[model samples]
Target: MAQTGSTYTKCRQVGTTSYNKHMFLNSECMSAIDCAIMCKEVATCTAFTYDDLTKTCRLYQKIETINCELNKENGGITFTKETECHVNWETCGNSCYFYEGTTRRTLDEAIEYCISQGGYLAEVTDEEELDLVNSMIKGSVLLGCTLYDGYWQGRTSGQKLVFNDTMWAPNEPRGQGHKCIQIWKDHGKFDDISCLGIGDIICEKVSILRFHFIVTKASDL
Candidate 1:
């Protein structure tokens, strides 16, 4: 399977069946990487693409994204199971992760990790919980590491934004540069923070949107 830009530990080598729980438990293909296994709380598990030519399994990361004909629950596809998270986050696919890669990256790198997973920054939808999310960070150990020192200037990786469709709050960066806006309850005033400021982050599947239906890189058949 093609690695997601960065090397990870013991991910499934091949097959649509991921999450090590019941490896290949619900598969039909006899000589190929068949079936995809989703966990109990997994809301989205899209169709997996496993190429015999390349021997790579590309898992679609989305909530209710994968649409496979439900065989018997016993006919589930099990892949390499890593730590499945069930924190206070929404269900994307069969998993809900706050941080994509826990390698202590800056805001931009972390955003890349999320997009690579077919998502964006864990944008908070409400103000009340958004405030709590900010207050909750004062004493807790942060998730990502900072690449810059002083300012929260993390829109450097260049993601041209169009927030006119979004609720661009006052004092929020409307121009660009420090364009990657974040949320916080600074002094109970909901304000837009920069992505550079280290804080807990999360990513939930927005919708079942597949970017490409072809494999970019994989082993030859």
Candidate 2:
């Protein structure tokens, strides 16, 4: 599986000499992978140093220089960010999303587009996720819900709609013939819209974390 978020390159026996002032977020992590995940969670963290002896991860908000000195006395692993974004997707909670802004597509076309990306139309399960999706979309966008036999169901596995009553706009669904659902970007509210309508699409898939190993000698640092 592919990893999500920042890329980390590990360097051993090397520690920053004068950039300690740039340290920002710090927490205890089980492994280097956990440290990388924590660094990715912090928007400003660009690099991190993990102390194997202390089991602590130190994140840096900025790296003004790459200078490093041999510190064999201290057991520390430094990871620098090579890139951001997990593959071609963005991380949100436990899922990865791909925002389509090229052109508006009908509901059917949107579904196909998401499938092409190895995902499906975004399925929102809670208010938090709904807000996350809303933040990514500027305008109305197609969701996974579709009308079936007078009831709304998700396009995948025919899962019935069980959203909270508050999720719907006041007097929404309106018993209209509209068979598809679109989420309003402003408030994360649901509204039934015509299936033929064209709108932006959000694709969702399971998130994976990728890790790459780079062994650097003391002289290479």
Candidate 3:
């Protein structure tokens, strides 16, 4: 079944004309779909409004109004966060990362598991992001970048894995038999190892919401 309020509606009257205190950022978007995608990618965006006339996409950290209202003059629509990061997934930057510490799996198995959960293996983009992942993980975890042909490529982005000396451990990326990458907990640096070895899984997904409501437990009730 289709989700309610997923489609855009025409604006009959002027709602909130000026940018309110709730708005965090605004950008240019071609369509409502593009606006929605932008909102999803932002970690702090809980709601958004897109102006058809000006091609303006406004992202809000919180929605002040009960309903997502549209701008009458611009003939635009608004959208609120309808979904959130999956349970046990941590929101970081533009993606939701799930760190599985206890269970260990091979590189192939880890990739399959993340794919089954509508995500891909975790890809550390920068030093700052790597530090955040290092703080969350208890032990060594498998990463998304793998040795493809000759260069390292990300499974999710299909892009070359770019890194500096600071991103890697001392004498790492052991070329020959080592085909997979892992984040060493002790040093918090990238390490290349054989794909057959077992390691903790870290999964990454993009579609996430800012606010996550707590689910009450039946046992507590």
Candidate 4:
């Protein structure tokens, strides 16, 4: 209901529901956005209800079929966690990634393309992320890593490139004048290549949906 920062996605409203017995946590919040934040902080919180009039937020640990029922009153709005991400995005670990296979672009063009899709070039900070990204690529895929003035840096966040010894394949980065890095789908290793080389693009961003509830007349309920 409330839009805040752009890093994380918002929560969606599920209309007024009767779930008095399903409540597990109760706290005071200034608005539905505050309540949603509180719910996200708790790993067990699956759903929540915020009372606009009383400024109270109720969280549910688990949602069951019996816990939901249509209500005519406009006292509160229910927010539920969306299980599925948006179309064309794949859920991997805690983040969502979209791979563009239709078009190939240079390193600079790929970075711009990812930004235009509400995301940045995918950043691999750890082995798990690296493995996940490698699994998604069919062949060679462009990464966020770039060589700037002889120093490797992540183009997405400008972070220094740090990798384990095993991350780079033996005798890799063999090409001269290669400034951009790409991951091999066969071995999940990094290889420095020319920035002019066109490859598939991968975009990473938060995936969430926010929906607001609408209260109708008592007769309509």
Candidate 5:
């Protein structure tokens, strides 16, 4: 069993049966990590299996404990389970967010830092997500959405953004050239400001499970 926000040790082999609700064939999964991300996206998914031979990934609602088979070629299958995020990160709505206030980084610097850490600026699209992000802010922080080409857009998806009006503070987005968005910790609302402005940084990426390979003897098959 895996504990949320803790390391997981046990792994399992897939049985002959397959769960069809969430399947990632070769075209969808380039690696086991990709498969894990797919599993993480589904709130109901509890485990996943990546087949090294067919390059297939499948999701399950529970761990498999019977009818296990081992491939002749070193098993060639890796099983993984959902686990808690790493330190300093919060997992919600199928995404992982990292908030840091110790050092302030400019918008560009924040983007660079997030890229270096394998994520991008946080993008809060809905009120639920916005509220979750708001709860994490100790102070203002740069978000992924920015004013681009006369419209607010999410950098990751490049789609037009339409957040709830209540998310913004009174008379907010006050001036021109204040394109980047920030979450004001005091009010838990948003404010538009210059991209060059500095503040705490929030990085976001798809939720992921820690990697753990299962070992099963041939006799167990």
Candidate 6:
């Protein structure tokens, strides 16, 4: 059965194309196996989802988008652009990370970009997504967000923010837009904020199935 939780962004096909049987991907994050393994271990991982927003993997579940870049030369982990990645909760720490930028954006716009990159807004639900979000929470970085529309509060219309587990401060959202969440320098820790706010975002890799083994198994079957 297909899981139901979040709604990721998808293109509307402005024009016609030769074929509709194509998948686009980018060179980012750790291997897809790593992401899958992590998601499998993370109980909150409802969908090992990938947002075509920016052609990147949104490991966590949030209502906003992230623009991340790999550490040109992280300590010694020389992960290449072509490396596959998985979003399973257990592998959050092991998977590669992109430098989620510190730019303010609207919630709708943010999510749109994330979809273009092949991932979706963060989806924090249980301890798994919680720990994952906090791990990436850093200076000038916004964790899970709740824009003016209040989407990340775990409840929009009737949908609940299933796996989210973070604390929030009262009377935040100082932005004129007062939409995007932000972590002020004076703020205490990870909590709900606005989307127009600026902060570092986290992303992962989308796994690609190794069809060779599947093909072999099918033949044997």
By TM-score, the best candidate is: 3
Clashing pairs in 3: none
- Scanning candidate 1 in windows of ten residues, the lowest lDDT window is 1-10
TM-scores of the candidates in the order shown: 0.28, 0.54, 0.64, 0.54, 0.59, 0.37
* Full-model lDDT for every candidate: 0.36, 0.67, 0.69, 0.67, 0.69, 0.36
Error (Å) of candidate 1 at residue 56 is 18
Per-residue accuracy of model 5 over 83-189 as CA lDDT, tens digit each: 56667788775678888888998888898998888888888877777777877888888898889788789887677888778889888878677888999887788
lDDT of 2 at 102: 76
lDDT tens digits, residue span 1-221, model 3: 00113323322222333444344565766776777766665556677766668777677776663132332232334466755567887766567778887789988899999899888888886776787788789999998887888888887777777777788898887777788889988888998888777889888887444432222233423
Better of 3 and 5 by TM-score: 3
**Between the candidate structures 1 and 3, which one is better when assessed by lDDT?**
3
lDDT of 6 by residue, 37-148 (tens): 4343333332232333333332322212111111221211111222235443223322332325666455565455555656544543344444455555554444334542
Candidate 1's displacement at residue 54, Å, is 21
lDDT of 1 at 182: 44
RMSD of each: 13.4, 9.0, 9.9, 8.3, 9.0, 16.7
Q: How many clashing residue pairs are found in candidate 6?
A: 56
Each candidate's clash count: 15, 2, 0, 2, 1, 56
Q: 1-221, model 2: which lDDT tens digit per residue?
A: 11234444331223423443544555666777778866665445667766667776666766543223224423345576644345767766546888887798988899899899888888775677677777778788888887888677777746666778877877887766888878876667888788888888988876653434344455653
lDDT of 6 at 172: 41
